[model samples]
Target chain A: MADEQTTLPPDDPVRFYQVGSFAVGNRLQPLDLRTVQAAQDRPNALTCGHRACQGCGEALGARYALDAAVRATDGRLVSVNATGCLEVFSTPFPETSWRIAWLHSLFGNAPAVATGMAAGLRALGKSDVRVVAQGGDGGTVDIGFGCLSGMFERNDDVLYICYDNEAYMNTGVQRSGATPPAARTQTTQAVGPEPGNVFGQGKDVPRIAMAHEIPYVATATVADLHDLEGKVNTAMGIRGARYLHILVPCPLGWGSASKDTIAVARAATQCGLFPVFEARDGEVVASTPIRRLTPVDDYLRMQKRFAHLFAPARRDDVIDRLQAMADRNIRRYGLLEEAAR
Target chain B: MPVQIEGSQAVARAVAACRPGVICAYPISPQTHIVEGLSALVKSGELPGCEFVNVESEFAAMSTAIGASAVGARAYTATASQGLLFMVEAVYNASGLGLPIVMTVANRAIGAPINIWNDHSDTMSQRDSGWLQLYAETNQEAADLHVQAFRIAEQISLPVMVCMDGFILTHAMEVVEVPTPEQVARFLPPFHPRQVVDPDDPVSIGAMVGPEAFTEVRYLAHHRQMEALEVIPRVADEFREVFGRDSGGLVRPYRCDDAETVVIALGSVLGTLKDVVDERRARGERIGVLGITSFRPFPRDQVRDVLWNASRFISLEKAFSVGIGGIVSSQVRASLIGHPITNSTVVAGLGGRPITKASLHAMLDRSARDELEYLEFLDLDRALVQREIARTRVGTRSGPAAENMLRDLGAVRSTPH
Candidate 1:
């Protein structure tokens, strides 16, 4: 089964490109491909002082995703927020971090609500305005999954984005349907013989979305701003159900350094733990290839949720099992496209 | 023109006449026929320009209505007991967000053992959800209420629940003088949303109102609901003038001029209660009927003004508040607080059991003697209840309480054919 080799970054100096100079709006660059974040007048859909935990990957992901959506729609966008970290942290009852026409409904109903908003807009002949529904992992994969599937099946004209940080970060880091195996969560404690979360428990919502045969289904990470932004732009170009899943690293829940948030997300993709890909109508269109593959331990070692395997005595079997999962994804999706071939 | 039709179909036509642009619903009995009729009309091109959405669940149906209503499209949906309960969260949301969505609630009983029969328990459980609840006394009234629901909801920017007795009114075929489409158009004006989703003048709807303003927002809803008591009769007059029918109003009274007793109730049971009152009046008794059309705003002042002279009133209703006796009776009693009418509740026709005229007469007779209990189950099997009680006393599980009673009495299910 192990026909392919996992290669770490070479010992020699490697090539580097202008990766994130355009992290903010590249005012110095041409307007055609400029990021909304670079534009001085860009709509900061999420403004300041969100109560998101320090180095919150969710907050970063939301801003990137929504800012791009706003730009794509030419500032004519309405967002429905499912109840989670984004809803609670941004809106503590009276205050809100949103600067756009926003609605915060109960958890798991954002997709349905957004579907309604889209239908309402079309009925009113305001089809030019777009709608976006966003939620955290717990809301997306667990509570709101049915509404999401319904939206896709109906081909509702709305984009549903899921910010996946593994567990229910909003409710004190309990395990959600998106939680990775062997990850320690409040509900999936690292105490029993199995240690952390039992193997093969969580749902593969991206695959589920693909199976629904929606117009677009994409997986991205907070570390890849360009890829995330491009997918959002592509989604806005289509006028049917679209799903965007972005894996974000929670500093508090993962027990990682706030400064290492982006690094953690990068390691997740580079180690083939969360294979980044895009599909259309249930068919794989393209995927971000792993430039330099690393072992699963390289990604897990940074997060405290997986620290138990390395503590006291090394749990090589647990590491091997987890590596097999990552390798399986790599092979199934052909994540190392040309390199594997 | 007067035509005999299934009450569900009649209400469907009535709702369609209101010219809702978007119709979304998930079928649940006895609410199924309404949506079925709507879908047929939609398919036949009779409902042109209407978008009929077959949603996956009651939650999606209400959510679709919310979306349509939020975007300024006139929206309507229908559901019953479990469906209503399924969409309960969105029900509160529709009202809280101030969306003018109209939904037909074919009132049925909620269940632990799972019953789908007629009862006010469904709508009763949602009385505090901040939507204006209107119960119909007959098929004609139920049909007419749908036309008015849109007008009142749109005018006040609030959702309305037009409840009719499940099966009793939803499935029963009856004579109803449904107004012509043009007449309904004139009576119920086009839905002009007070708030809309527009990029030109965008405004945040369904905002997260915190403690600082949550109480004030709820207070506004309460005040607006209270305003319906006045607006209800006003619209009813307009509806009568345009449609030439005496159907809907906050409260309707019959033969109460020289009455010493009044039998009050909601929904179709009110018609049977009125019949019993008429028979008593024929003989030498002085009794009247007060049909509470608007059970939500409660129509406290209007009811007090109508039944002011009655010495005693008995509420023979299809729904009760479990530990609290009655849902509508408490409101009736509170309305006549300063007045001198004695109050009694007779919980009847639970889970689709028939509320016969003879039972009403017996209850009225007891009320006249000043010997009626505060709360009574109209035709409860005493032996079965006693047996269950005895079983519990002996530390044994009273298994399938209702079925045990039915078997003990050698009785099967009952449905009004």
Candidate 2:
């Protein structure tokens, strides 16, 4: 997905302008401030040339967060991934675009495997290094939820990152526990009276993580690379069982154009559906406020999965339920920026 | 260290001695005492520096252990019967990820009738979960094998499940010569995580592999398991040198060489069978017992080589595959298909029924008559069950299908017992 950009320096200068806008990035402003991903000289942790569909928010979120993590640690990280779309599309056999030390764990046990790694490192007296376990929504929200909670409850010395792509895209666009209500997936058909995923079902994993009273817990969207990177950097600063759940929209799974990954992810947050927030010691300590409130329908109308919601007759009830759900999230997390009025 | 201990406590001591960094488990019948001992150990600071996670359910137990192991910890957990089945998904993931986390499985039967008791059905059901499965014939062995299980699992980078007979081994107490931490440390080195999460050299793990490479991945897991055969022996030899006990490493045989009839089985039932064999030996019957300690690696060659010369082999197992036969019976038949001996299978002691030495002796004696084929149901009490069912079915025409079938056969002459 890379094109030769023979322009100024490879690093995006926009990061510099945006650095002072947040408390997180400002901490690293004096330290050369090179966007690790933009530095062509450095390794692309999630390297280029892999079949992650266009506008694949998971891919973008993973890359930006990992690159920033690479930059944060000065190149001393090993990652254990759980089986899912991110794993399927990124590394197809012997060919891997990953330029980091990586191991693939089963679909439901990335946190457990990462715990082993952390323990192993401690045993070896390698205290300088840290671990980050990652998986897709299917692996994290459903299959690996118990494991994730266990890690938090015990305060394990590892960070778990769940790339929340609403459905199991690699497995033919099936519904994952992270899929929003009224969103159509291969498994959760759009033909039913309720149409799409039931509103009450599925997990609010980040809130669940918060309930564990963990050292750190945060949620971000791939739409904001700087914010995503900042969360990763912040998680790295903590030493216990930390969680960073990123809202990564899958273009293929959501049935949207590849270029709309960032847009969709951003829309998810702006519409007050997927709140961008962080929790510490079981409290919502910080949240990226929504600058402008967009209608939940605006976000849904863009994706084919939500196409049924806007059918010939238009099922406004389904849209209203979705909006209510988003509204609930907004009310719970206080997503609206104070001065947005 | 010496202490008054039940089989579960002994196993717990062994786990503590092994110095697992994380212990995640749930309470299950027969297996509860073991985790209770562990929880006590953790709370009392007897087993310090380990994360003791008391999870909500068996599923959570396994899942928690998985997370603990994933983040570079010597992880451990335990379960039995239905609890094992409940955590089936996480159990598979544990081994598939090649995490060297040790787990103790108290063997018990899966239920439809809701009976909570001893049986091999639980451990046998997960025979192919890719974890190295080890069976213990006694509480001492159960305690000791867990130490070796952790070392062997980490050495081979494969998960290991140490199976002990539910209630039989887990509930019974015996004086176990527990190893000191100093000795266990020498035997089992601290787990060195081969793959870990690091923020510095940011990497991704557990990446999804598609159908194109899934087969090869399984193939590699199989290869690693095969590698365990060699690794186990080395670890066992080292264990013996350090602890001064011959664990028999893979399989334990009981005087099978000169015997005409050999009773092959696993778990604590072998102790009873051994006594039965001794009694039969005094009666001029040349019979012996073969206790299989390792089930996953199957110990195929060792099994064949050990019992190859026996004129007849009676494979005794505690679990059945419903419409089929005994789980171990089928495995024995498959392993001894081309062997020199005639193998007979016995399905016995299901749902924690007492497996008496008399019945075991009778089973071996019956097998010696050559009336039993490759598979036989032992101590079934089928006549009594049939009579009881017939008596109940008399006035109940609306009974279940099986019961209805019995009713349909109305006055067919009851067989003389």
Q: Name the candidate that leads on TM-score.
A: 1
Q: What DockQ do the predictions score, one after another?
A: 0.44, 0.31
Model 2, span A1-341: residue lDDT tens: 22433234445535444533322353443334435554666557888898877667888888888888777776777677888777877777667878877777567777866665665566445666777789988889888877777778778788899998888877888887888887888888988677788776568898888888998999988777767887888888888999999988877778887877777887898898888888889998888888678999889888999998888668887788888888988888887757322
**Winning candidate number (DockQ):** 1
- What is candidate 2's lDDT per residue for B342-412, written digit by digit as tens? 77778888877788987776766667677786777777657656766776767865445444444555752
Each model's total of backbone clashes: 3, 43
Worst 10 residues of 1 chain B by lDDT: B199-208
- What DockQ class does candidate 1 belong to? acceptable
Stretches of candidate 2 off by over 4 Å are A1-43, A115-128, A188-202, A213-215, A309-311, A314-341, B1-4, B46-49, B55-73, B189-241, B334-341, B368-374, B387-417
Q: For residues A179-256, what per-residue lDDT tens digits would candidate 1 score against the true structure?
A: 998999999998977888988846999999999999899999988876798899999999899999999999999999
Span of 10 residues, lowest total lDDT, candidate 2 chain B: B408-417
TM-score of 1: 0.94
Residue A189 error, candidate 1, Å: 2.7
lDDT (Cα, tens digit) per residue for candidate 1, span B162-253: 99999899999999987679898678777788887655565555555667888899999999999988888899999888888887788888
DockQ of 1: 0.44
